[model samples]
Target: MSSASLKTIQSHSTRTTPMPRYTMLAVLPCLLFASVVPAQADEHTQPMLKRLAGVWEVEEGMNQGEEIPEKELEGTIMKIEKNMIVTYDREQREVYRALFTLDETKKPVHIDMTTEMKGMPPMKSFGIIKMEEGDEFEICYALPGADRPKEFKSPKGSKVMLFEAERED
Candidate 1:
């Protein structure tokens, strides 16, 4: 074979062989970046939960289009812990315990709460939570057997509950 022809063939082979390494180099950074993005988002939301670690009282609540009287809620206290929320009744009896997860990547932020009652079966509820201007926060959640709420507002529905709470401590 002529020297020029041999050199041309060698160059063509070299060009095709390096494609795999080039592709691997391109993909490595994306893989690394993908892994870190979720972790950083989780870390950012950790602080948001921390801010909720305190005592709160519900200023307003609606269940199935009926307004819950303030007197009925006055006895209820919501305590938010690291990964759990506990509700106490007027008699200081533990009424509810739920483990919750937050997804801040959503536009309005999404929440999943798994509640385990004393005599009832475990229930999972989907909700959207938002922090207001002050130390108040709101939650509009779908009851069991319902779908996730798209907006923070709950209309006249039988399976939706909305609570407006303020941090007492």
Candidate 2:
């Protein structure tokens, strides 16, 4: 198998490349080493995660048929303190926080979100997620008024827009 397919951490925008999963798994350790070192004394892991700590612009793609102007960030570094991986995006006063963690296999990350509004109900949601390579990933939010979670895709799928560090920059 190739590392491309298995590597859950997304990298540059895929160029129609049939990125093999096993390829990514093989490539990850090296890239992870270059990027993720867990030793507190090691200055990489926290910073790399921090690189994930920022705002991102969603370029609506094939799956997402609409566009929105603004979005922001919400979450804590302690989010990763335990086994949970929490995150969010903000727009003006409204905030959306997503809490999740790598699955038992630690490949496709599982995520959940809470949309906060002043006079409306908070939308609680979940998604089977992976890092949107190159600062982009999608999620299918579980709508409060709905039964099954609907399918969503795009740079911002459903209401779950994971703001990541833009790779181009």
Candidate 3:
């Protein structure tokens, strides 16, 4: 082979050579780093999310300054999964289902809710949640296109819903 041709072949062979040692060295640090990294606060650390997992009864509810009677919420069940929340009606028919994310980094804890109902596009709602004195917990969320609520109080005429719930444990 010519000198130039030999050099070209050598370069091609090097390029095709397996990088076993280098690959292992590069991946070792990543494995170690992943093992040592602590988990960030997710739904697991968000007490409200954990406490909200089980069945819940709407103790009190207010929508647009109108008080929602308990009977209206009777047999209503709120179920929280890892990253989803579901609500069922008296007949155990699902009324609403939402995927949510929690940011404990925010004071009062920020909650983003996305509800997908049948035949409708998903709706977004910004909310905050906090535990009350006892087993009671309150959540206030703004309707789609509305800004995050500053407080649990829903202003009149605004698409806001403020409600307190008790775990049905």
Q: What is the TM-score of each candidate against the true structure?
A: 0.69, 0.37, 0.69
Q: How do all the candidates rank in terms of TM-score, highest first?
A: 1, 3, 2
Q: How accurate locally is residue 121 in candidate 1, as Cα lDDT from 0 to 100? A: 82
Q: Write the per-residue lDDT of candidate 2 for residues 1-169, one digit (tens) a residue.
A: 5777645444554555656879989998899797766546633333334433444433332323344333312221212323233333333332334333333243344445455455767666555443454455444434444332334443434433322223223
Q: Which stretches of candidate 1 lie over 4 Å from their true place?
A: 1-46
Candidate 3 clashing pairs, residues 3+ apart or interchain? none
Tens-digit lDDT track of model 3 for 1-169: 7989977877888758645768999999999999988877544455666756777777788897788888998887787778898888889999888899988779888899998788989999999988776567788998899899888897778788898888787
True-vs-predicted CA distance for residue 93, candidate 1, Å: 1.9
Residue 12 local lDDT, model 1 = 81
User: lDDT of all predictions, in order shown?
Assistant: 0.82, 0.42, 0.83
lDDT at 20, model 3:
71
For candidate 1, give the lDDT.
0.82
Per-residue lDDT tens digits for candidate 1, residues 1-169, read: 8989976877888646544658999999999988877544443345668777898887888886678889888867789988798988778789888899988888687889999787888899988888876688888889977988887666775688888989888
Better lDDT candidate (2, 3): 3
Error of 3 at 105 (Å): 1.1
